[model samples]
Target: MFKIKHVLLLSFTIIALTIAGCKSQFEKIRLSNDVAKKYQEAMKLYNKKNYSKAIILFEDLSQKYRGRAEAEDLNYYYALTLYKLKDYTTARYQFKSFADTYPTSKYAEECRYLGAYCYYLESPKSSLDQTNTKAAIDALQLFINFYPKSERVADASKYIAALRLKLETKAFDNAKLYYDLGGFEVSNYKSAVIALKNAQIDFPDIKYAEEMDLLIVRSQYNYAKNSIEIRQEDRYNEAITYADEFMESYPQSKMLDQAKALKADSESGIEHAKRMIAEFQKNQEKYKAMLAKEAKADSTNTTIKTPIK
Candidate 1:
């Protein structure tokens, strides 16, 4: 009889839990349905071109079902609304979340692509922060990698090329900076190579090729002229390196003659400095006697006094 009572108690407990779970589930479904209904109404307004009212309803629906399945579509639409309203960052995150959660979705692909575009659309020109454009390029690459045959592949490639031009502009500017700075050994050399190579890659047939080569020549020439004799030899050698690059990359450059002349000058300047040093060393004894006399006088403990002889 006692065992029977225990069994009866267990049965009652199970019934109570089931009833509670059903109540909880029903509440969730009711809430989700209400939010979904609001989303539809907003979409209808949006279709009717009632953008402002549609935005309000979309905002409400999104808030109501914040963590539920019904929220997915609403979030995407919310992002679109924000984008239309010119609130970029919020739109980007909403689109980002949608993409992450629904990778296989048709809308997800668009979100993934457009999320980066949100950044790109706000991106300034090549003179400004290229951070957004770089990020967009990366995101586009990923999209292409994941969906090779997607219809958006062509569009992604187009953007990549456009962004590439921005990068090219930045590189050209850097090289120009070095040239303007009068080709200081460190700063000029640093930016020149970067700009030259990038220009070669992007506008191989453009005037930048010859322009960069000319810049390299001028800066390197001045650098070799002022450097110490031994260091000058190294600088001349470095200049030769630039000459070689020009020859190889821009064989037909109108600047080739100038580059060759500079190369010849570097070769001769190194030799002249070496010869001058050698001639100096040939008179080393005379220089040493002068220096020794100066050292002896400087090291003397006694001060010179006028002495009567």
Candidate 2:
């Protein structure tokens, strides 16, 4: 057992020393003043997939080679090395810088696409804040516009579609949140209706179109049902309109029956709301007439006695 432990320790020491020696050798190359040698070593490391070391060398070379003809290639490789290291944020900036600085370089188009792709990669899921998702869509769309005939256009279009879907999902979730909160505050039903409508307007090809339309009908009806008497008739009428539109647009929908039922219910609700409003106006008129009659009687009783004067 003692002999085996000694051997294991010796092996570990040897491995650690070998790693240190290799790192020292790389450090010497990195700190060297020979620009050509540094550039070549960096390229060698990058080709070998030793990106961690390659990036350091590339960073130094970037500063040394700036304003020279060699700077273009160095910058491109630097950005690509950062990307390979999974440092997407910096990589994206570097890539954009490369394209902007080298508009005529052979790698400019590729760098632009890569920069946009980095944004796409950074986009979070639908539930999170979607700033990055929107940015990705814009970038990818711009790429498509700039390079309409490029091979990457197809990939960019596909990515744009995916990002738009994410935005749609976020909108759907937001509208649903308002609907869910409707029971707590009836005004949220109105908000839900508005949000769902905006979602449709913004994304005409939304996959959740049918579902969103159904929600709009439900939200409008509920909003009308819970609203004050004066607003109920108008809101219920709008609900009926939405339900009709839904059924017209999706006759074969699995939710056809539900939509039809909502339409019928909304129609009934409008009638009921109109009656209630009419009854309220009638009561108001009666109240005003009663006050007028009381005022007239008081005026007659309080007449001045001229004979006493």
Candidate 3:
């Protein structure tokens, strides 16, 4: 019985309030005046930098007068309040919605700009995942296309460029760690190659891109050339192969000239060793002939001296 009485009272209260709500100043021609008073309070909070409170009041006003022609105005301000308060995720949603709902409004272009800015503001630090940054770039580009004459177009483009540069720097930074760990010069797994490949993708025309390529080639060459010489013939052939690869890759490279010259010197050194062995054998035979002759002469001299004795 008590629960039934409570339900009846709750229904009555809701009906009464709904009636009063329809009769309130909000539902009258003086609605603009009432809304203006409420907005004045919100503006005070906003101007004082109490963005949280301002956002709360603005959102209440926006919801209360949802279908009113002025609701669009209140919503746009509410989005701005959220942005100022650093509530970027919802701010982006609100700004994007406001732009769509009020496409012909004077603030539509700015709404699009702020939508992109909200994403830009939420972008993570460089060390963190850059999904937001990339999203921001895409949104900002869309904003540019939709509002090409918007004052914020340049600013949005600027943010995208900044984000891209940061992302590229992050990629390069990770690649550099490989070089730092000494993995680039001795193994097929050197870091310079990975760095160069990504660097080309991140910044194809970047000045460091060429340098990265050079480092990769140099590391590969050094790695192959310096492999263990357990089998002289095997190792020599591998070295020659690597040296040839280096030459073909960087034919105009200064290192290519040095590599070719080294190969020639290695060949000459091997030939010189062969010639030295042949000459040494010939000299050994000549020495044997001279020794034989000397021994013969010594015997003659010895016979002369001994017989006389």
Quick one: best lDDT, which candidate? Answer: 2
Q: Would you list the rank order by TM-score, best first? A: 2, 1, 3
- Residues 79-193, candidate 2: write the lDDT tens digits: 9999999999999999999999999899999999999999999999999999999998888888788789999998999999899999999999999999999999999999999
Which residue pairs of candidate 1 clash? none
Per-candidate local distance difference test: 0.76, 0.94, 0.72
* Model 1 stretches with alpha carbons more than 4 Å out: 1-41, 48-53, 67-70, 182-214, 282-285, 289-309
**What tens-digit string does per-residue lDDT give for candidate 1 at 1-309?**
999999999999999999999667544543555765667767876777766766777876777777887677777877788777777777787888889987877689888877766766766798887888888788788878877898988988988778877877777787677667653455565456556666767666544556767777766766777677767888888888888877887888788898888889989988998997888887897889999989888878466778899
Per-prediction TM-score, please?
0.68, 0.85, 0.59
lDDT of 3 by residue, 1-309 (tens): 999999999999999999898557333522444667778777787888978767767876887778988788788889889888888899899999999998998888888888898888888887888899889999999999997887787798899888887777677666655655554445443455566577777687554554455455444444434444332334334345555766775678756666676556445444554566678788999999999999999898877443554
Show where candidate 3 strays beyond 4 Å: 1-37, 182-191, 222-309
Q: Which stretches of candidate 2 lie over 4 Å from their true place?
A: 1-13, 274-309
Q: For candidate 1, give the lDDT.
A: 0.76
Report the number of the highest-TM-score candidate: 2
RMSD of 1: 16.3
